[model samples]
Target: MYSPTPSDWREANRKRWDERVPLHLASDYYDLEAFRSGKDPLRDFELAEVGDVTGRSLLHLQCHIGLDTLSWCRHGASRVVGLDFSEPAVDAARDLAAELGLTADQASFVAADVYDAADAVPDTSYDIVYTGVGALCWLPDIQRWAETVAALVAPGGFLYLAEFHPLADILDDETGSRIEYDYFARDAWIEETPGGYADTTTPTVHNRKVEWQHPVGEVITALASAGLRVDFLHEHDTTLFERFGSLELRDGAYQFPVDRPRIPLMYSLKASRAVA
Candidate 1:
């Protein structure tokens, strides 16, 4: 495993993500063939929560490979921009956008870190600012992230975030039957795994990476402090992936077995900046 200084974290993460772009594009989990055939990866809850993007401009932060970003375009977003730190991912998104017959005015991808998004993207603000699941854990500073997210939302617009619940991070990864990690710990959690989440058997070289655990209260408070009002915070018993071995796919979502007690495995929120 690689133990990197704070300054090295972004570079390390970028390398790992960049290397995985091709792997993820080819992975059966992503199923690019199906995607090209008009498969939408945006979860049902995301569609309901971010209702009616028609004629709206959207900016998707940490938008890996831009699947969800373009999906929004498919739903009638007037324009969409997808941003990511990995250049490879950005390139893949642009190619996919072209293949989908979307013009630059309809969909664009930018290669930039999330913290620099305010200056990196084409617009000063968007009708909607969206972040998808598994994005927050990669960020080290929740306050900075909240502030960035807030800045990207246009007046009268809102930010929609869906992520795996931090509570799930505390439990053992194998069975998730016991608490094996500290939810409040601020130190960076570094791990080196052999394969990407999209395909566990695939060989990957840049496996070492850093992650953080931001509690639910901390996230909500940070957003509020950033001048965004919390419209709602809804916790769910289902998650997008098999976060734990104990979870099983049910109705297109991963959850514990029917016989097992339920827990909040994921959460979604809407926070808006008051109309100026």
Candidate 2:
């Protein structure tokens, strides 16, 4: 029975993300150099699913270091704001935006917990609320998150979410055959991850953190309950990273073995608020 205050878990995860900022900045996974040279941080699936963002207000939640957030700016978003709980991550995001010659009016980063995002961000509703990979696991309550997301989206606007499939989370990354974790969110998945996903060679000071799992049904239900209408849900056999040791890289994506049973590695959903 693992139970901790929400503040405690949040602080722990925030520390972990804060420490990973520097490593991600220098890591090839993020490729800050290429991003500076006008490379788009967004993936092909999200671009196709979310469609064009030209001249629209976009808010990126759990946006660490703001690569995707700034990329939205390049994709023709009129206004962009990135929000994260980690101060270091927020600071680094601001620095990168500045270094890339992006004015504050174009893109900005704010330090705030996602649960408290409604209060942290100035505008109540944005044209688009975009959240990218590896962001939702850190959250403890999906219902509350959905509420915040709902509130952030304006009437006729949409919330775009792209995350690792919950099925993938349950499977053992080492073997990829047996289920190692619970599919549903019963308790916190506490772990002592010394090295993060970005750079495994370097050890982190904030090693202990908590994570939660939300199945596809739970995710959609939460959004629906929050008053958002589901437009569509898409699953992919490919993932952004080589989560499993046996995965093969092709066309810039990591996928399971050809002979093995295929399963969804990631999912993307688009939900929109009804017109007033």
Query: Quick one: best lDDT, which candidate?
Result: 1
lDDT of 1 by residue, 20-111 (tens): 99999999889999999999999998899989999999999999999999999999999999999999999999999999999999999999
lDDT of candidate 2 over 1-276, digit per residue (tens)? 245535588878888888888999899889999999999879998999989999999999999999999999989999999999989999999998899788988898889999999999968899999999998888878999999999999999999999999999888879688987677646887888798777999977999888888899999999999999999999999998888998999888999888888899999999999999
Clashing residue pairs found in predicted model 1 = none
Model 1 spans > 4 angstroms off: 1-5
Per-model TM-score on C-alpha atoms = 0.97, 0.96
Candidate 2: regions farther than 4 A off: 1-7
Instruction: Give the TM-score (vs. native) of candidate 2.
Output: 0.96
lDDT of 2 at 234: 97
Local accuracy by lDDT, each model: 0.92, 0.90
